[model samples]
Target: MSTSLAEHVDALYSAVERAGPDAFQAALEGIVEATQRSEPAEVSAALERLEPMLARIPLGMGPDLAQVAGAMTDFGGDPASVLATLVERAAGAMEQAARFAELHRAAGLALPDPGDFDAVGETRDRFTAAVQVRGLAGEEEAEDLLQAWYCGDSWVQPVLFMNQRRDVRRALPQRARLLNGVRATREYLGTAGWLEGLLLVLDDEPLIVLDRGFAGTGRGFRVTIGGIGDNFQLHTMLAAALIGHHLPGRAPAPAEVAAATDGPDLTPEGGIRGSWNLVDHGGKWIWNEGRPSDIPHLDGVRVVVLEPEPYQRSWNAGRAYPHMAPLLRIDEPLSPQEAAAWLSRCTTSS
Candidate 1:
């Protein structure tokens, strides 16, 4: 087995398989080189190697391409089935990656530079391991857990329940903020990300506001405005929250809550504006992050807004999106009926 493309493929997979505790650097470099070349046989061989671990790769970033391609091949028996599987599984990986980052930062670690994920590309191996790396999951369990993550925003429930390590799953709610973070983390908030935007349909109002990240544990537990300081705060909150979330504990003490507040938000956009919209899409609730105009058929649907939660101190840039322009004012966890009544009773213009 000379160092053909196939060898590179194997080497890349081996890197993803994690040759050593810190072999990530070498594995990443090999992956970069492997993607630059075109060797179908080697790539095929590499794909075969990944065939077994295919279920587990998305628990980290090293296997986006591989997962999709592998699904295509495996789905040869039932193409539609694999297509559906890949779509949902990809979504789960997206959210889990975010949760992983939330935990990573909570652990007092710096995020890897974007350059670290540059090796990701169109090919199988390159795609397989691009956006994530190996996390705590093994092959057999990874597929189910990862898929469950994307299936719903409350994915943390299943992930937390499935894994015995409360310490790891506890990180699912790092920052208690909206799903906004690095590429690996932020990507899950929309598109490939699970949990659609929040929607509020108001009567006599010009806009039907929507906030994509409203109340899903899929969003981190600790929220940030984009600074190490915020993560530090979240770190403290996580310690307490994780304990309460996982173990039997009371709410934050008065002293602890009072001491929790830090200085004013340093990020731009002047902090939060209002509570997010929880739109009803069919029976499922979508945290709509789109513009009111996006749902043109809905009358007077002028704009969509990302309503802030005054009770929450974490940072959320969801409002910055121009599409989420129309703001809807409502209390926390407004029920669908309440939102409709508030909208109907609206006496003033949006």
Candidate 2:
């Protein structure tokens, strides 16, 4: 804990009585002054021990504080200044809440940026060149209709500051905990536990928040497109990008969103049958891999799709799809002998 940002946090504790925007600045200066006076041997020894220990554990993230300190310390830079910037950015994230001080004093100090990349430029290039976004609803479909469009996929996980009240997500206990690399934290803590534990775990790094909700802008809210499903902004454009369809450049207005065309609508029977259909409609819609496809449910057997890359499937699909879900359910019905027999027969001969 001492190797982490505990000292800078103590400065924040000391400086809060001082008041205002300058308080953060003062706390920053206080940290620099304090660290500069500490015995250089103590700091160097701590960093040397921390380096190899971090290597063994593998947070699987870009860099931990010890790594940062090593680079800065070895390369002639200041650890105090580096920590001040991290605290400042984190403070900006928690600025809105009444609980800011308590949270800041606790977990707010260790969060890191999820790492930045040039998203807009990447979106433009990837979408424009994708051959995957072509037409596929029989020959009657116009070949030139979608000849030039973006068919890229997007996986957005919005990270909110721990200060905000996530009451909406908290109230419901049913959303899926879609576990992938991006959502690993949410999965490890479990979504409900994350909501409950937010205030308690402030010092933990990689300060982004994830939910069972969606990839969108502004606390995950945006203009509603009737066909695009819930959570507008990013999902709208991303859904458009994924299937490569209408209003693909940006999301339309709340009024315009309703009128804008989306992907293919289901027949009286549920499910989409073509590439063009997949692009226009939204929600956790699964891509039908070439040809009209439906996996039949067999007695005593259940099928589940786990963690698709672009994440068009809902984590909450335990409720099932409209028509087919009624027939299929999840369970472990086979006894150990039964399971072994099935596995042996399936693998050994045929």
Candidate 3:
């Protein structure tokens, strides 16, 4: 017989051992009655007891139980009903285990030293060294480094870096996508609600990085950030966006605003004309590289935007400025009026 069959038998025997003969017999009877009458509740109750029993057995037993479960459910309740349901559930668990096992096997995986993830001490030292080599300093320095790395000529290096670091690569992408999704949702809702509890971001690119943070309730926002990235510059920007501001709360940056507003006018051939190049919408022009076909289009593509509430507040504090003179510029946050003016300029330029 197949190994699966043996596993099923073993699981059933184990269940019998744990529940005793009397409970097992009663469960079997319940399965039979439920199968015969097509009563879901009876079957569910029977399965509940049976499931715990099966959990004690090795994963290999799953396929056998799954088969039995499927057969019993199909057989419609009888003495065979319990066996059938068990088979079905077992099959599912076995399949999942098989997949997980295969993934680990393919990579020849092994555990890393605990020191690799030491965030407060050695990890910080490593980060400091990296930043120093890049000649960047201070808190905002990290963000600047990341932006330069991603948007600069050496962007490919970071991508490769993430790909090579197995531990960090596995988790970074997941975390990034999750953060983006949550930000988008909050922006759509138009509320300053907090994302309470622990949220983790994982990416599978080159570096397997994990980012953890907490969102605040009420008007205050609290966030803690940490992660490994292929490029310090790209990761810094990502961290800022993830922790500094909630999505949709902030206006686009000057360059992004320019692109969004002006994009509709620029044609593929260069000058604005009636027949715009559909390709231009999808193309990207790297600094001096001209237009590249590989770059995807953003025209009409929906994206989430995040703004700093504190920045907005600062801008508003300067509301008393005389309208006649050029609005007194401040380094702090922009108020609603200042934000509007900035947006208006972007719109007009576009």
Candidate 4:
């Protein structure tokens, strides 16, 4: 006698429980194959023949058979097409089952309990929001930020230091404060996880943070923002200029880093020579009084040290140089034009 639909489903579920997701998929494949082999009339006759048998079995196979039958009809009596649809659906179900199984296995292997897995979805949403900000800001600004903060030679050492000293989330918040004008305290409110905290940076400086986020890879808060200010702008501007010069199709330059660094050096007239030192790293020149000053000569002007750094070194190993040194001394206070020109030259050189 033909096996009842209810009996088949009972066996299918039993196989699923005993042999896992793979067996469940195989059972689905078997059902599809059975459907494909029988003619429509023959399949109908078999269903009718097994109706009584189906009623006798305890498992709920009635709905499954009916659904399969209905699907066959929907496919315009193409049993093969119906089988294909069934296989596709079965594959999707098997995938879900496998995922759940893996999740369960992971739960068993120490660490956190499997409490609803809602956080994964929530994290994805936050990542999407962060990405959305990047989309809203155009590419040029994004590239500028990335090159300045994330890429190039000088970024490596500072990035390592920041990573060691600060938590990723906290550092990110500070960076947001500087770049986006958002307060660090405001950005960190009720932040739960690292990913969420990183997203909070975007919440403050959406344009700046988001732009850089796009040009990066990895998961779980990979972008570093803390030391971006010192060098990122210069690198970004230079990269843009290089691209503009080299690539015909790329976007125009937004702004240049030279604007920040290149300005006239103001010193006393008749070339005041004093010893100066490289006091700070932010490209500021400072010098101290009481020292023989041999500064670089240009345009009948000599550079003097305005601020002092007693322990300093110049290119000349034996020659004593100003601790806080100046590079140029313009007659009188430097005019805006002279200052601009001098700054332009310094910027171009440095």
Q: Which candidate is the best by lDDT?
A: 1
**Top-TM-score structure, candidate number:** 1
* Candidate 3: 10-residue stretch with minimal lDDT: 319-328
Estimated TM-score per prediction? 0.26, 0.17, 0.19, 0.16
* Candidate 2 residue-pair clash tally: 8
Which ranges of candidate 1 are over 4 A from the true structure? 16-18, 61-88, 94-350
**Candidate 2 — which residues are off by over 4 angstroms?**
1-4, 26-168, 171-350
Clashing pairs in 2: 107-202, 107-203, 159-209, 243-279, 262-280, 263-280, 263-281, 284-312
Give the candidate order by descending TM-score.
Answer: 1, 3, 2, 4
lDDT of 1 by residue, 142-227 (tens): 33333333332332222212121222122223222322322344343333222212211122233233322333222211111111
Which lDDT tens digits does candidate 3 get at residues 1-350? 22232233344455566865555445444444345454555444444455554445333223233333433433322323243223233223323323322332343433122223243244334444554555544435433322221122121112222222234234333334333433433322111012100122112212111111112111211222222211111212332343334322223333322221223321122221110011111121111111111223233221111222221111111111111011111123334454343333221100
Q: Rate the local accuracy (lDDT) of all candidates.
A: 0.34, 0.26, 0.28, 0.29
- The candidate 4 region of ten consecutive residues with least summed lDDT is 203-212
1-350 in candidate 2: lDDT tens per residue?
24333365455444444554466455545444444545665445433433333333212221223234433343333333333332222222222111222222243232211222334344333322332243212221211111111100011111112112233123322123221211333322222222222222111111111111122111211111111111221222333332223122222233222211221222213221111122211122334321112212223221111122342322211111111101111122334454334333221111
Backbone Cα, N, C clashes tallied per candidate: 46, 8, 51, 22
RMSD of 3: 23.9
In terms of TM-score, which candidate is stronger, 1 or 3? 1
List, residue by residue over 221-308, the lDDT tens digit for candidate 4.
1112221211222123223432333222232222222221231322212222212232211233422211212123334332221123
In model 3, state the lDDT of residue 281. 19
